[model samples]
Target: MVLQVSDSDPAKWNLALNNARNIQQDLGKGNVAVEIVAYGPGLGMLKRDSKVADRLAQALDNNVDAGVVHIMKRQREAWAYVRP
Candidate 1:
């Protein structure tokens, strides 16, 4: 499934994250691949003080070595500013 997030609203970020989580849960872990590519203003939502940090942190903690991957490498410069 392809999901796109384009705003910096915390609510929108949570929805996108929840949707992705739901899909991953529904399909069963490791049975499906889910990736999030944050770009434009949406990338700011992944910044140091965004509201989504805790959820993102939990996800990173759980999946770091699980072979599940995400984040956009399209614009390397912009990507350089975001940390898991």
Candidate 2:
């Protein structure tokens, strides 16, 4: 199973991480995959220059891959977005 977590709220990001932890605990005996895609304002949560970078870095250390996708981009501007 692939557990895809995506949200824009900082609090919700915490919830998603907690959910992944819980799933890991419950399914440790089985095979499960988790992927967290952070975009939009949520991208702020995983910004290379963000305060939460430490936490997100830890998550990445724990096998949680944080990714960013620019859903819209123009010569003058860009829009990062994600959905699950």
- Each model's lDDT: 0.60, 0.53
Candidate 2 per-residue lDDT over residues 1-84, each given as its tens digit: 232334556667776677666767888826555555554467666777765566677767433233333222211243222233
Q: Can you write out model 1's per-residue Cα lDDT over 10-55, one digit (the tens) per residue?
A: 8887877787799789988688655555556876776778889888
C-alpha TM-score for every candidate: 0.65, 0.55
Identify the runs in model 2 with alpha carbons over 4 angstroms from their true place.
Answer: 1-8, 48-51, 61-84
Clashing pairs in 1: none
- Residue 31 error, candidate 2, Å: 1.4
Instruction: Give the range of the ten consecutive residues with the poorest summed lDDT in model 2.
Output: 67-76
Clash counts per candidate, in order, are 0, 0
TM-score of 1: 0.65
RMSD each, Å: 8.3, 8.8
Model 2 TM-score on a 0 to 1 scale: 0.55
53: Cα error in model 2, Å? 2.9
